[model samples]
Target: EPEVTQTPSHQVTQMGQEVILRCVPISNHLYFYWYRQILGQKVEFLVSFYNNEISEKSEIFDDQFSVERPDGSNFTLKIRSTKLEDSAMYFCASHNARGGTGELFFGEGSRLTVL
Candidate 1:
């Protein structure tokens, strides 16, 4: 089965630095989303995008964050300035909107550590 793929399963960065986490979503899916889990916290939605523009974004997706589909297969999340609070596991998901309720297929995760 086709699956979402994320790179750099683990990363350590200093606070206030820039970081780009990469993902390659399932080939045939139309909608993509990004979510993060802060340590023991519940998974939180960051943003969802379709047709090359943002469909919805949570408050957590602040000015310092951005996303892009740089190619047919790759979707990327960029943080202009990271913070200690940014340490979390970022998961990339994709789904076929044709299904009435969205059921997402997620990548394992890209774990970010800030200090």
Candidate 2:
């Protein structure tokens, strides 16, 4: 079976620096999403992309954040600046266009740590 894949499983950056997390979902999937977990907190949705545009976004996706499907296969999330509070496990997910309310297959996650 195929699955979502993320690069640089772990990232450590200084406060105020920028970071970009990358992901590759199954080729046949139609929806892409980004979610984050702050340590023990529940996973929170950041944004959802469909048809190459943002379909939905949460308050967490402020001006300082952005997502792009630079190429047909790769999806990326860029953060203009980092803060200690930004440290979390970022997960990349995707869902097929078939019959279903909404079901996502997620990546292992890219852990970001800000110092």
Pairing residues by index, what is the TM-score of model 1? 0.96
What TM-score would every model get versus the actual structure? 0.96, 0.96
Which runs of model 2 end up more than 4 angstroms from their true locations? Answer: none
Residue by residue across 1-115, what tens digits does model 2's lDDT show?
9999998799999999999999999888999999999999999999999999999999999998999999999999999999899999999999987887668999999999999
RMSD of each: 1.2, 1.0
Query: Candidate 1, 34: how far from true, in Å?
Result: 0.3
Residue pairs clashing, model 2: none
* lDDT of every predicted structure (CA atoms): 0.95, 0.95
Candidate 1 has its poorest 10 consecutive residues by lDDT at 95-104
